[model samples]
Target: MAGGSFALPKPRPSGPPYFSRNQVANVLHQVAVLLELQGANVFRVRSYQNASRLLGSLSEDLGELVASGEIFNMKGIGKGLGSALTQAITEGRWPDDWIDLHTNTPPGLIEMLGIPGLGPKRIKLMADELGVDSVASLKEAALNNQIAPMKGFGAKSQQRMLDGIELLSRFRARRRLDIGLRYGEAFQRKIAAIDGVHRATLAGSARRRKDTIGDLDVVVAVDEADHETVANAILNLSGIADVKGAGDSKISLILDTTIFDESFTVGHIDPNVLDAIGGDDYEQLEAGGTIDAQVRLVPPHVEPFTLAYFTGSKEHNIAVRQRAIDRGLRLNEFGLIPETKAGDLKGMEAAVHSLGAADEAAIYAHLGLAYVPPELREDMGEVLAAETGSLPSLIETSHIKGSLHNHTTLSDGEASLELMADTARKMGWNWLGIADHSPTLKIANGASAEDLLEQGRTIQQYNAEWAEQGVDFRLFHGVESDILEGGKLDHPDDVLAELDYVVASVHAMTKWRGRDEHDNTEELLKVIDHPATTVLGHPTGRILQGREGYEVDLYAVLEHMAEHNEEGRLKAIELNASPYRLDLDWRLCKHAKGLGVPVAINPDAHSIRGLSDIAYGVMTARKGWIEPNDTLNALSGADLAKRLVR
Candidate 1:
């Protein structure tokens, strides 16, 4: 849990595969745990533990460090440990002892180590005293009241283990959108390189950009003659660890996440999660995450139809199929043909060939509809909108000018203000906003009012320097002020009034969610009416796959925001773009658009890398029918600053 996710080296065609610094470091960390569990010498265990942390913190390339022999010169790593790290990186082979330790350890004990606050020592104690080997056995022990009497585990601790097991089960059921996309896109790329693959596109919920995905779907186009060759090649891809089934037309695979490159973000998938689900489940859920994938091979002629069928929200497909039926035509993955009698198969094939639908757009043209973007394929009136030629041009990533809710190291962010600003300039953005946490949220090292004011002066100084250089960029100062119980903003109006904006968010859900829905709605309404409140952050307080949003009357809240905007108060709802919390749920974004209440696609970023998360927000915006004109951040800095003025 100390280092980033441990990933197996992806297979390389020409040279030994490369391993990320974190991957190497995590391997050491796992070895340390194994050493301790095996009762190795205290100094020996400490060596691995110290080296793992050291390697994780190093920015240098692991292979280069090992090759130049600089790793041995480092403080904690001696020759023996350094040699193990070297072999893993240069030869793409984990140290023999590490593999042997894994083989000998009961996989159940490894999983038990994943429980929060349960370390290797605690796990060893459990196995020795109660003979608990797996999560199921641990759960059984806890349930049977056998764990409570243990010296270190009381009733409270036993209860927590049960709860942690439940949470782990839920995490394994599906993967977050970010994780799914990383694997799906990587798999599609590999498939496209196969000898005869004409085209490869991701389908299913992944194509629709859903917040969580159960399995990935990919549709490949190939000549009929190449189906067998292509399918065989796909099964042998490096990441395709397990084949569920294989055929000329379809292949089911379990993609190993360990083989994915470090470019894929794995920080969101906690290391504790990987540690707890060991063995086969551990392989299935690679430390970064693993997923089941299906590849469908179709002839080039039927590719369009197959893509559409697979890239479906079931309801959307059903509605379109019904339309075809009403027109005395049949729409299937193969093609659109006349709805003829069963005995007229030859005529049906002829009719399909004669239609000459070349692509998904052409297929839609045959149905008298405009092209519906895959994101809009949900059956939420998209069919009717397309038929009427009334779909709005959805927001694109380029439309964003700047975000008004981001953080710096002054609060909980990983980058400094200067670094964040420099990154934004390189990104070709006109402005960036710093809305570090207010003092009430101590967990984030929330900036105090004095700290906030000082930061404002720092921002002013940056603006002055930019102007002196004739640069067009600007920085707005603000706070992600907590919406306290009963709807009070964290800072007083006097403090809030000095800043450019305020993002009022409900962080302590226990207080707000404890009330009735009406009361919860009223609390948010109070924030909306606050003269200093500029935007509402993560409106639903929902984290995809982690938990459901708190119950509140979002309709009433959106209406209040709309009413305030109509009164010229200029309220905006933030579509928090952190992949984990694409809140303001796309389902409600359209309603906000209709209410004429501007939506702000704020990344709510905690680091400079996090700034790119806005792309995910833009996708969700497009899915919700949001356009450039409907968002606050789409405005240039000058326009946005003017609008933020009360």
Candidate 2:
């Protein structure tokens, strides 16, 4: 599992595709480790360690910035570490000393560090003192209760380790839903191209729009005579690693992603860094995840019913079948038939029945239920909602008219104001809100007073041009002001009031490591109380796999915001669209909706590519039961402009 051809691209330090922030940060971190291993000066080690963290947290590309000769002006990264990064750029590897020190470390010991929630120091303790060198060994120790006897890792830590290992089994089997969607879409086209194929589409959790996906289920309908030909052709496709099953109706293969899977770009400091960067998680999952496509030869009159039946969530199928029984009809993948005992219909993926054709609505009509969208097919009261007439009219991608709480080169963003606006206009947006960092987050290049004023003037000129061109597109000047340790905005009241919008966010204020919980929630409440505060950006400030959200009474903060919505104070809660920081998380967004607060699905985009993350945010929003009216950016340009000033 450890050995493979490491054809890692030689990172170009100055450009678009440098090694990830995490990879570079990990190098710095490893330098500190190597220095420690060599008994180097404490200050020297601390400097590297600090620089590692600084680069890890950076929103801007440290490589590009450093390559641009800006690292000298930056705080935290001193000359020594900066030189190391510079050397790494040209050498195409970490310093030789780091490699030598890293090689001397015990084999399989790094795997122990892969355990989430456990740092290297602790892993070393286990490796040196307890002889736990691998995950398997660690899990065995935990299961045998041997790990419970350790000094720091007691019974609780032992149990947690065991649970994490169990979770790892599941996590390693599934793909992030976004990745699955890509694979699913690519395969759909390939399957549809099988001659005589009528239709091909994804099923299972991918169809249900789950955040993570297990093995994919694809369903195809074709002519009865073409089933063999279609199945044979798919079995012979290039990149089909192995054929697991080849039946008249089903063709199962392990499609190697090597054909279509791009090198998934990754950032460092992620909890899943080893799994993603090492390509272990990708290999482990795809090696087991099978693509099963069911080709049912059905009449044109019966394809829709077949697709609906095959594209089922098991719970949904059970509910629908129960409904069919109530109506004296039987629902199965085969089609609708007369009511029959379960024993009579066993072992049949296909069956012939009465009173059913292709369309789902017609079948649902027979069962006295409404057609449920595939994404809502989970048994989350959708069936009952269908029975009644109250299904939520979910928000669509088209409903979003603008983006808010965005960043540009004025702050840490890689793109400029002109570029951000161009990207927004291309996406059919009527307006955009640029809430660059206020002067507190030195790490994110928070704008100074002069910088904000200059950006404001630039936005003014852009607006004038927009008016001149008779274009609806407009830009709202805003600031993502930091909330200081207490409750004050990073920028002055006079400064914040000058902007069209304000986004007060907790940067250093939240004691994410658990120093203060009650106070942190109170700090957020006070920020929300500010009359100019527009949206609470990433309310929890969590990186999903990397870091837990800062401790705060989220429900209490949301309730407080709801009570203070009179003058549109804390007007909207942001569903920040970064893959790592999907905060306020969907669960909390649902609560916000219940509290009558609208959610804004902001990409929190620092670059143009970041704008595409809106889809992920929208998916999270849909999961939160947010509708167009429940979202703030659904407002048009003029309306949003008016609201921001109000």
Candidate 3:
């Protein structure tokens, strides 16, 4: 009306633009890589690396630190880096020098950095010595017998380069769950707040909580009279990079992530996550990334049907459509209509009246079935279970009372023990476990037996003090002990017995990956049979899109855990909650539940912010039909204490 036509509300300018902590850290990390590739001073490169690590580990708001100029006071951040960070954080732009370095670097060299086993040093060597800059050129060199003759690289190493290049191609196809949610939820919020939109909800594989997502889908409900206005408003939203298509019912867009408002919580991303999805790709996602999104607009009368149809696994939709056909009805995204001889019922008027459904649940009820949740809509016995009223009471984030697998600065983790405990307490957890890396995992800076015991005493002191103050908080000390050759754990039984529990994980990937599935399964069975082993951590060692994980028959491994658990020994399988490794794959979680083996939803966190990754794990658990009773995270501190005393 003010402009002679309806207009969407403009977002208020919030002074100077500020970047998320993640964005600043990522730019700094990129600068370090670029400098290293250019053979810049080693100390200069190390400064950026240290700054990146420090900023990443910080729980404080980076914008506030920059505003107050307090970041300059931190150790290792000199005036030069501090000014650069200030400009990057407060101005929403990288410094010109850093940009120049990035610009001069070949895009192919950056891509090669992600090709596992290839670091900045080796990549520089290839570019200079063999004229190989990209994966394509590197592959050509390897195929032509040029790489084997190079110094420090033999035939075996040449083959690995070939293998890694193939893996890199697959990583480009889909973004991980966390990255997809960042863009999807951001766009959904923007559209939902528009003037003519009634309600907006995320749909598609993202809504179903799939671990990897291709494109995003958002459904919006609007009155018939407001369709044009709402569609215009969405296309005009600030983050839209391009309008792929616009129609009365559907609008497609390519969203730019870099332009989103500060209201979106761009949380800390683990380095492993960055590596799992290629670093160059993740950097693009953080700095100037674009994702494809479709916004579906439907009238309020058919909103329920539209939402349900769009939030689907195709197989689940087919099953429900078949169910509708069997009952003399035709169900589609518009509405459920009766199978009349005259097909005039295709219009919304006939269908809404015929179905008399107002929501997704009501639609299910009308079909003589209970409502199936979005996560369970994968066509894996859910239709029959809903019909029989036997669907599980799936686990939620609130059901998690504590976690048995976490880390601290004592090992590779970024957060110290005290900070980790405080963060857990703030999350309203009654207990928190510290399972730092054990002695043999040297790469992780594994804690020696002495150091671990010393940390246990500190935890004992904290537990005693909390008890004295009636805080109802406790801490458990554990170690993520490595499972070595022949199934022997990294730490001796004598040392392990001194801890509250033990998390046995495989860090020796080379040896484990060399074995066949049967052998790998047997190795896992031996770890389960160990008297001190409390949980199996990240059972598959898979890094989502990055690695295929070691070959192991997880079903056989779960069976072994089940057998051990039934014998009155406490054994559980960890659903490692890192977005990069939701291992104990969701597909296998139900089998673990069926076998009566408890699932431990471990964050395997390395920082204060990482504790919240449990939310992703909960989504995975619910997808696998796991209930609260089937997971160790749902157990109370006191109850879990008793359960762990094997």
Candidate 4:
């Protein structure tokens, strides 16, 4: 059972409310829709849509006003809509037509809208053209040539579509940090081999630790004379499916191969053959010629830089450019240039044109701003930090002392507690917490009251034995309790009190959509404030691509945690490190840290294979700018136990 902390506000008065004018309008609109769908007058349907739009724009909650029995006093609510509103508010059911329309819409079609290039219209067309209604079907159709013959889709477009689908399929839904790192290393090695190249680094999403990538971007510096050689060298690299375009300064490849895909012929190519191919020959080979390749050099100063800049998230780079513009400067991937240079900035966005000095710091100086690291270039708080020279020394992997949330055979986990403890010791951890699931989660073999007690005794025995043997590591008794409907924990207060530490979570209440049903965020806050609850586990309840977690206002939850901490709440937020569910998204870590909320970077490991995921968690923590002191696992075992007790 997943257990986590949450606090609930005092319950408001229950029962149905009188419909307000706005509520009446909304209900009337729904009635109109139902009426039209059932072959009612067209005018009535139009009225419903219009009224719905109007009601949605209203400032106050119509249901609240209706509950107060004050909605009848508002204008524009005739008897028809008023009746519908009252019924809906009291019973929580939509009118018939609205329900039917929702039912008729294919759920698969709705999911297709989220893919990058596919829109609603395109999805409908694909459904009509190739009978593809789901992502899986659409991908199969694209790969199998069902999409190429469609109007407006040529070979190139089909390839792009297929590439997009394949990219999405190959990587785990959220993309892993390691994929980006691996590609970065590959790019670095390729660029470093160029005779005149001084430096080559990857920036953008990869630097930000995004798990998947659309394309790889590499920035390189070379002597003006060697620019063409570097560009040619890059274009000549093996495994490039297509050269999107090549210019003197930069080269772009639509990667036809991946580190994981071995079926591609290049994977088996001899190193000697790879070395022997000239840039032109390589380009020809990449263009689908014979193995012998040739390449050419072009001027490198401008194009490579532009390509690098363009490859990043345009929104992120645009914000940076705007900052430079504000200071009478222009910034691009190459460097910062003066705004009055009397040249078009369009093509040269990535080229470092006019900065007086080399490196990012010098470019920032030119713009009268301090340098920002590539990793923190997302424009969140990095810009301000640069100006203040108060950038955080974000926690890195080495700062972590141990993992606080792990599983063993006592639950559904693959490894036993003793094995996990031994592994933790080998990893040089000063402490480890074994937090198996509580009993309510039968699928995971969650522990019963007796099981938990036995586990605790075993942990205590192991701790003593290890201490006697000078093993130096300590194991703590912990359990992950499930949060049930109505925001209640699986275990009672007495059972919870027996554990050395409790990590509360929501494993079952994922389907509760109505905020009124359970204030999930508030409930989590309450659990955090619970005397026995020490950590909130996987706060979002997301499983990466598998499922989006229960709806909770993350910012609100973080703020509440921060506020409670000031009141001496000992609750800590979890950064679960199950690669697929790196909950507590790194993007929000900095904000949590800013509030002085301690974050527990837990592996959430279920087995020995899962244990290695701690590295990913540590990377995520670093990305969030978490400091060692701000992380719960950074504490020594005794210290961690004491902290939990508090």
Q: Give the best candidate by lDDT.
A: 3
lDDT of 3 by residue, 256-338 (tens): 66446764443555554456556656555444555678888998878899899999877688889999999988888888887
TM-score of each: 0.71, 0.67, 0.72, 0.66
lDDT score of residue 438 within candidate 1:
88
Please write out the lDDT profile of model 2 over residues 520-550, one tens digit for every residue: 7888888888788888888876654334556
- lDDT of candidate 1 over 338-371, digit per residue (tens): 6563236652254455355778999899899999
List clashing residue pairs in candidate 2: 22-268
lDDT of 4 by residue, 581-608 (tens): 6778756687788788889999888777
Q: In model 3, what lDDT does residue 209 have? A: 89
- In model 4, where do residues sit more than 4 Å from their true spots? 1-198, 211-213, 222-243, 256-316, 340-353, 469-471, 492-494, 513-518
The 0-to-1 C-alpha lDDT of every candidate, in the order given, reads: 0.80, 0.70, 0.82, 0.63
Q: Point out where model 1 deviates above 4 Å.
A: 1-171, 262-265, 268-288, 341-354
The weakest ten consecutive residues by lDDT in model 2 span 1-10
Cα deviation at 41, candidate 2, in Å, is 59
Ranking by TM-score: 3, 1, 2, 4
> Whole-model lDDT for model 4 versus the true structure?
0.63
Error of 2 at 423 (Å): 1.9
Better of 1 and 3 by lDDT: 3
